[model samples]
Target: MASVSSSRSSPIGKLPVDVFDSILSILNEEDRDTLKNCSSVTKQWHDRCVRIIFSSLDINNKNTNAFPAFQTWLSINVDAAAVVKTLRIWKLPVEIDVDQLASVLAPLAGLQNLTLQFIREPQSQIKSSSPLSIQGPRSRSLNTLELLLPSEANRSMLAALTVICLFDTINTVGMQGFSSLKPDLRSTEGLTKVHQLRLQYLPQACASEEMNMFSGIMTSAHLRSLYLECHSPSSWDGLRILSQTFVNLKFVDLDLVQLKNCVKDVDWTTLWKALSSCAQLQRLRINPPSLVDALVTAPSKLFQTSLTSGGCWEVLRELVIGPGYSPRAESLPNRIQRMLWDLPGIVRHDLRGPFPNLDTVTVEVPLSAPMQKRDENGRSNGLAAPTVVSSEQVKSAIVRALPSLQEEGLLRITVIGRT
Candidate 1:
């Protein structure tokens, strides 16, 4: 047994070089690149490593000289071309001639992921022989597509829109533009596989109308996961529309604080109704004002009723109450306690709260001083002890309010605050 173990541990008696090279070829490009750099130290390692490292290529610069060289390299290494799984081409000064772009991308039929960025301009006229004009059906293995637009105002909106609308099999899509436009699903009807969508920097216009359109798109597509961040107030109407449409959603992360101006005139009641309707919600993260206020102002019957009485909080697994807006020194803890207790389904009684299934509670607290350490003798070290409420007291209040939940299996609680 000892002789067998010793032989297995010896790298000198490992598999032959060809077998090792074949194994390394299966790794992703980042790992393959590392192996390639290490292989260059010796002639024996160089031949085995270079094939895997150069198997995938990224052409990022748009300079004329690099483009031709890249084309030449591709022509000389036809076998290696089939191994490329990811392609990223960017910084093109002018809108690429549709035919030229297609010719470059055609050889990469095996590409599973593609990214095009920094398109300075897009052509108004589609070349008759260009790939852009190729309307016949073509099968592609592409599943993920990311397009980044230049920040220039004169950028070609038509070309950018065309490129985005063309990907038929994309399952994940990300775009950064002036406004998050819901893709014309009609244009990419074959993209039924798409489940994840991200929209950033959406322009604020007539918030209500745009939001309605956006909601219509989401409901029609049955998107499962969504991330939306907008900086303009006009984006609020869109958010409100989403709150109304995505009631059956499972996961959502909304950054509405970026659109402070749009929310200035927000209808709190409508937003609350939208939040209450999300019956299948598993994970949710939004700024405090949007989520906390809705819970506090929800109908009294919703909170007062038992868990089996169609209360919305019964399904919630996690609750996070963030910091208050500009808390006053005199009534900070009072306000925090009131907000915590007032939360529907959360009880002040010893452990009989409505959140029976709640396993975690996160609350943001503010501190006036640094925390002090306790000595082994059970005495305070007195290192300018922070004027903060005791965790035990807070825990006691929670335990008393929802004893039933704690008894059932509640185990973890976290309080987040600034010192």
Candidate 2:
């Protein structure tokens, strides 16, 4: 392989053919051959393959006692832990001591991301942050934290907050599919990353707790990029608070899919007011069917007064909107219309500075999901699939809806498929 010295090019693609072949062997599940061949290829390939393979560690002690495997084998300055950047703990044994787990994780000095996924674990809230407050050889700061606590896990919202406060400095945090949290207003200083905070698909149960948690976030001098899914009135008020303190937000993903059922509760006037504070905003994404309707049907006056001529998202360069699916739930379009009737003429006229500095406008077509088929037992797939919507058709519709975007050559269209 004469390609060894070609480091100036793409770091991964520049690998020699033999090295790629070893990687292909692994992808093809020739695991025995892969371990043998990859290690034997070259010292460089050996280290690279090991790093790529173990860069993300998943621990589950319930089935195979995976924690011990890490302690006895991978943690060896065989230095596998040195390459681990993402750590996921699945169903950490309820009886296991946190101190023991902390010691095991001490060797992952390069770890930057942590995910706590509770699967098959008994319902018990973590009592304190001590379990996650590691005094070890690992890096002191984590860049991201994600909690995937589905209903099956009997999710304890308190446990979620406990894990978050452990890191002295964490930049990004995501909590998905949670039901409710017992109210706790105590603040922690760790989440000071002017980067991102995402809370999606949460039920409208704990409005007070939601306000407490998110309002505290609003007070953070370090809070930057935020994506919140709010269905209740109080939570939207939290958005009003965000407007007052959103000093450094650069990117915002506003997914209004959950608004399908609770659109009435939202004060569009308040939402527009909140968006007016993103003085540093560079990207704004208006996502999905119901959200499109919400935007289109909002009173024209809300847009007129909320943003000033001198301020409000003037620096925004990117705008993403739509999937021409009918805004009304009952009429799902099987084929794309000649015009994206759903989008109407809002973005070109209403949204930010009329987006004077807008550079790129992306329009996403609804995913082309094949119609679901029933099995011989009369059971169907989980998704009630829809007819495939062509990207070309969607693009054409978008051009009709916003002719200026096409004329100015700022329009781009996308259709994500079932991967």
Q: Against the correct fold, how does model 2 do in TM-score?
A: 0.67
* Candidate 1 local lDDT, residue 27: 74
lDDT of 1 by residue, 298-326 (tens): 42222243333433544667655444332
What's each prediction's TM-score?
Answer: 0.56, 0.67
Q: Residue 167's C-alpha lDDT in candidate 1?
A: 44
Residue 368 of model 1 has an lDDT of 31
Best TM-score among the predictions, by candidate number: 2
Q: Give the 10-residue window scoring lowest on summed lDDT in candidate 2.
A: 1-10
